[model samples]
Target: MFWWFERSGEHLRLEVLQLAADKYELRVIDADGTARVETFANADDLAKRQTQLQHALSSQGWTGPHGWVM
Candidate 1:
């Protein structure tokens, strides 16, 4: 599953995808999903504000290896 959010005043969009394996893919897409800035990380720990947002997701709300807990 994926949720889409448009940045307040930009043409960019943030998409949060929930995968079957408990990981996640975040894409900063343009007006259209065709063009995007992509990043991959663990879905569990996905709320940290690290310098590298991509890395932050690797351990943010991590609970287990099979599914989301938070």
Candidate 2:
């Protein structure tokens, strides 16, 4: 799933995808559209990081859909 946000004239994108068995990837696009990728060993860790990012963005006045918990 993917969530999009905008704050201070910049765009943010968060995406989650399953790469393989028990493996997942988190893709984040920063304000300048710089992409960062992280791999998670489990769903729980991914969920935690996703929540953290959501909170951080919300605090910064970002407006978008909340992340989907897998």
Candidate 3:
């Protein structure tokens, strides 16, 4: 799983990639996906988010693909 965040006036963007087993990598990208800042973190704190994503694919009356998008 991954996500990006952008602000109104900044040329910088943040890309977060979820690795496996509660690990994740973050990359600060330019508007064109050029890397500016890169780092990794133990994403165990994101347990709830992970569960929510799974539910979105399979539960609460939803259905479709499973797991991360990319």
Candidate 4:
């Protein structure tokens, strides 16, 4: 899945990926091209972290998670 957040005309991207049957990754790429990657062992953990991330982003004034599954 892919998501986008925008702030002051800058865009940031988030990607959810399954690296293996039991391994998943959440990647956040900033508008400046810096990337932060986190791995999870299951969907539940990924979901929780995604929520936390969204809240943090929102607090930072990012205006969306406009997204789609890939």
Candidate 5:
């Protein structure tokens, strides 16, 4: 899955995918090209982290968790 948020002129994207039987990852990329990747042991942990990230971004004035499956 993929998601994005924008604030002012800055944009951010997040991509989530499974790595293996018990592994998942969330990759974050910014408009300027900086990127970060996080790994989780399972979907539950990945989901919790994604939620936290969304809340943090929202508090910072970013708009839309607008996303679609890839």
Candidate 6:
């Protein structure tokens, strides 16, 4: 899955790819091209982590659109 959002006048992109039956890769990239990556054991785990990040961003005043902005 892939997602994108705009916050604080900046664009951010997230890419989630399945690497194996039980492994996945997540890549977060900023508009400036700086990127961070992480691996997860399963989709459920990834979803949990993503939710945590969303909460953190929201707490920091990062607002998302009603649907996907990308």
Candidate No. with top lDDT: 4
Compared with the true structure, all predictions reach lDDT values of 0.42, 0.87, 0.47, 0.97, 0.93, 0.75
Could you tell which candidate, 2 or 5, scores higher by lDDT? 5
Model 4, span 13-52: residue lDDT tens = 9999999999999999999999999999999999999999
Highest TM-score model number:
4
Ranking by TM-score: 4, 5, 2, 6, 1, 3
Residue 60 of model 3, lDDT score: 36
Candidate 2 clash figure, as a count: 0
C-alpha TM-scores of all predictions = 0.37, 0.83, 0.36, 0.97, 0.93, 0.77
How would you encode candidate 3's per-residue C-alpha lDDT over 1-70 as one tens digit per residue? Answer: 4443334433433345767666666554555667754334566544544455445534433333223345
lDDT of 5 by residue, 1-70 (tens): 9999999978899999998989999999987889999999999999999999999999989997888998
Candidate 6 lDDT by residue in tens digits, 1-70: 6676677788777777888999998787766999999899999999888787667766867675223432
Clashing pairs for predicted structure model 2, backbone only: none
Better of 2 and 6 by lDDT: 2
- Tens digit of per-residue lDDT, candidate 1, span 1-70: 2333333333433455666475665554544546554444665454442224434333443221122223
What is candidate 2's CA lDDT for residue 29? 87
> What is the Cα-based lDDT of residue 23 in candidate 2?
97
Better of 3 and 5 by TM-score: 5
lDDT of 2 by residue, 19-44 (tens): 98799999998878799999999999
Name the lDDT value of residue 11 in candidate 1.
41
Q: What is the Å distance of residue 51 in model 3 from its true position?
A: 22
